[model samples]
Target: MILPCTSAAQDGWLRLRQALWPDCPEAEHLAEMAGFLREPDKYAQFVAYDEDGQAAGFAEAALRTDYVNGTETSPVAFLEGIYVAPQQRRQGWGRALVDAVTAWARTRGCRELASDALLDNVASHLMHRALGFEETERVVFFRKELS
Candidate 1:
């Protein structure tokens, strides 16, 4: 089952997020989850649970008025992150979590939903394609330090 995240689910959500993005500090996940729980209308997080009530995956999304790649509409529903536990993948949990986000975005009057993944992440690329997202474009980013 899919459900909107609440304060009571924060700890579990944090754990799953940490597992997904292992290099990120736990504090960062906590802070970001807090923001979503505080203002659900602009930012939302949904959890997918198995029959035993364990969290299997999660999806975080937000309304982005800024330029969203491949989307012509403003105020696009942007998927910030999504992850399904390795043990729980390929069972439709990921799709269910995304569907929840899609419903939420439509209710928020959004005309588009956008998401991106690292160029080298093949799993993410295939997942997006399976979920009906078309490839927009790809470009490597560069940064230079200033004195």
Candidate 2:
């Protein structure tokens, strides 16, 4: 089953988020989750549960008015992150989460959905393709610091 994340206290969502982004502190995760909840129209999140009612995965998406590479539409639904428990992968949990996010985006009048993965994460690339996303572009961001 797929469930929308209606509360920041939703442990399943937080747990999956931490699993996907292990480097982020719990406090930071909570803070960001709260922020997303406060903006329901701009952000959407979903959690997937197995038949046994255990959390299996989670996905977060945002409506971005700013330009998203490879997308031609404004206010595109951009998938921020998605994670399925290692033991739960290949079981359609990730697809369920993305489907939920896509439905939410449609309600918000978005015409397209966009997502990105690290260049080195080949698994993610394959998963995106399996989920019906086509490659748009490859970019390497550059930055410089000046005092």
Query: Which candidate has the top score in TM-score?
Result: 2
Tens digits of per-residue lDDT for model 2 on 1-147? 998999987758888899999999999999999999999999999888888899999999999999999999998999999999999999888888889998999999999999999999998999899999999999999999998
| Candidate 1 wrongly placed segments (more than 4 Å) | none
Task: Give the Cα lDDT of each candidate.
Answer: 0.88, 0.92
| TM-score (C-alpha) between model 2 and the true structure | 0.97
Candidate 1 has its poorest 10 consecutive residues by lDDT at: 6-15
- In angstroms, the error of model 2 at 3 is 0.3
**Which residue pairs show backbone clashes in model 2?**
none
**TM-score against truth, every candidate:** 0.93, 0.97
Q: Which digits, one per residue and each the tens of the lDDT, describe model 1 over residues 1-147?
A: 898888835536888888878998877877777877788789988888899988899999999988887889999999999999989999999899889999999999998889999999999899889988888988788999998
Clashes of 1: 0
Check candidate 1 and list the clashing pairs: none
Error of 1 at 117 (Å): 1.0
